[model samples]
Target chain A: MPDATEGSATRREELLAIAAGLFAEKGFKNTTVRDIADASGILSGSLYHHFDSKESMVDEILRTFQEELFGQYDAILASDAGPLDQLEQAVVVSFEAIDKHRDEVAIFQNEAAHLLTFERFGYLAERNEQSRDVWLTLLRNGIEAGVLRDDLDVELTYRFIRDTVWVAVSWYRPGGRRTHTEIARQYLSILLEGIHCA
Target chain B: MPDATEGSATRREELLAIAAGLFAEKGFKNTTVRDIADASGILSGSLYHHFDSKESMVDEILRTFQEELFGQYDAILASDAGPLDQLEQAVVVSFEAIDKHRDEVAIFQNEAAHLLTFERFGYLAERNEQSRDVWLTLLRNGIEAGVLRDDLDVELTYRFIRDTVWVAVSWYRPGGRRTHTEIARQYLSILLEGIHCA
Candidate 1:
């Protein structure tokens, strides 16, 4: 209840988390500010005291998640590791994001197109292009280093990897039988070695 | 348009195509019956004379597409080709569906969850389960034939294949730089053999 305190800041983060779950489960357009408030066991007026609108809550949710994610990607790309190692690390980091920030990932996957229409959320489009660049860079680096097949269609390869990895949010449960790391390992296995018996 | 004639049937097919495009682009809920009529250059009443509601158009659209798609899958399964060839053929057929019936595939991908809640669209859920079964059958058969790697996690492998193949519809444009067959061939190479330089 105190303003500018640690407890108040924690409360703000908790509220954003609840809003994200709603935005992910219900389409962002279908989820009203009241729904977020109701899910948080707070009133609309109280929710407004923390966020001016549901738009502000979503903006904060997506931006904060992306900042943390892209930072990790930057570190991986900047690391002294080999290109193949860097690519593996990037895949691991992506699955880790799915595990740690499932709701945020889901919201971004489902609502990005709708949200990107507004001027404020234009960065979402840029983030998409940036993601493409990250994958392309890793693939190209691997090829140049003789780690990946030179005959690869890097563009299509990037699309396949992006679609397979991110779309897992639809079926990947946090507490599923296989851990996210296991899933990533298996995907990497298939990505690196042919599935056929060699 | 003539009633009870070949022209009537052809006209009906034309109307359904227009409705599928709208439902795919604008979303099923966001698109109105009148919008289909407007896009078809006909009055709403004339459109109704051909179809009862937007629901009927979408139902026909999905059912027709699935019938053709599943029929091709059935033929593939029954063919005398080896398990590996069968699996490859299935991938080729799927890309062909995305190329030929892009709107139907997109509509199914985007609207299946919403439409599945309705009583009449229960088949959509069954079709999803059936599609999973088809892939599982193909994969399990491959392993039994000693073609696929035995250590491979078949279930996880199925998901990776399903997610990667169908999601291409989002970016796989018809008559683009790559034909559907070329895309399928390249994907098969990557799926069968890892992208790593050997």
Candidate 2:
């Protein structure tokens, strides 16, 4: 039999997952605690047992997702791999995140701007800066290592990379034609070696 | 002295521009006829002298913008340029649109999905398909011409190009540090040559 504490923890995760889906499908402002509870087949009071409010629910969803994503990024940055390899690994990890956390990625893309206006969601803004820094560090390191072109505009390149990688969440389906690995590999190919044939 | 007819036409254009800005800033559904009239510093009834409803105002704004944009794409497709040049020109024209029609682009990005659900906004769905066909044709042509990699996934490439080009509206500010031309050039360089220094 499952431990009582483990059972409650699993149920909590399940509730958060249901809330994340509702938040992603309906705009965060439009989704209520009742809606999440209904979607989870629980009463609103029961949902309160797991989370106090929708704000806390979304906060946990975003915080947990960003923490895991940033951890992977930090690990890539700290790895002894060459700059180019680190950059490639970063792209791979991003697509993996999209595949695994599609709802979280969508919620971040759609809600972060509005959410950041609130004092509690200030960390979202910091996360944006940290993401930018991660890409810039990779690009700058690549340039210094003489692998990436010196003429590359770090800021624009970062924006391009960021846009291309994350925007995949809009159309990427988990069980769709291509796996996340396939998409990431193709994208890396185009990024590292232009589509122009030699 | 301004002619009455010409004056009304100019006023109509101005109102549409205002509506586009508001719809872009606060989403289409969130904006109301009174809000537009308020922004225009006119009574709601007087605003109705030009547009009967907020729907009409947004319709005019999006219609005019798409007509102008699609006209440019048709011209590009009909031009004597090679496939690669056509692709480059498409990117150039896209950034030009971002520079010239920032608010319209923002409206399309933020509200198109929601707006397309209405029967009146059905054309927006067609416009999306047309845009996809444009890119696919360019990618297919390039691959056939031996200019692009044969192994390229045209669909994914189209998404990448579409995302990278249009997502610029999120960060691109006209009269900012970089000219649209410069940004487009750098982006084209990255797309065509990759960032890797030979």
Flag clash pairs in model 2: none
Going through the candidates in order, what fraction of the true interface contacts does each contain? 0.78, 0.73
Model 2: per-residue Cα lDDT at residue B76: 95
The clash numbers for all candidates, in the given order, read 2, 0
C-alpha lDDT score of every prediction, in listed order = 0.90, 0.90
Q: What lDDT tens digits, residue by residue, belong to model 2 across residues B31-55?
A: 7788888999997889878877888
The superposed Cα distance between candidate 1 and the true structure at residue B106, in angstroms, equals 0.9
- DockQ of predicted candidate 1: 0.72
Which residue window of length 10 is worst by lDDT in model 1 chain B? B1-10
* Tens-place lDDT digits, model 2, residues A66-163: 99999999999999999999999999999999999999998998778777878999999999999999999999999999999998889999999998
Candidate 1 on B144-167: residue-level lDDT in tens?
999999898988999999989988
Q: Give residue B17's error in model 1 in angstroms.
A: 1.8
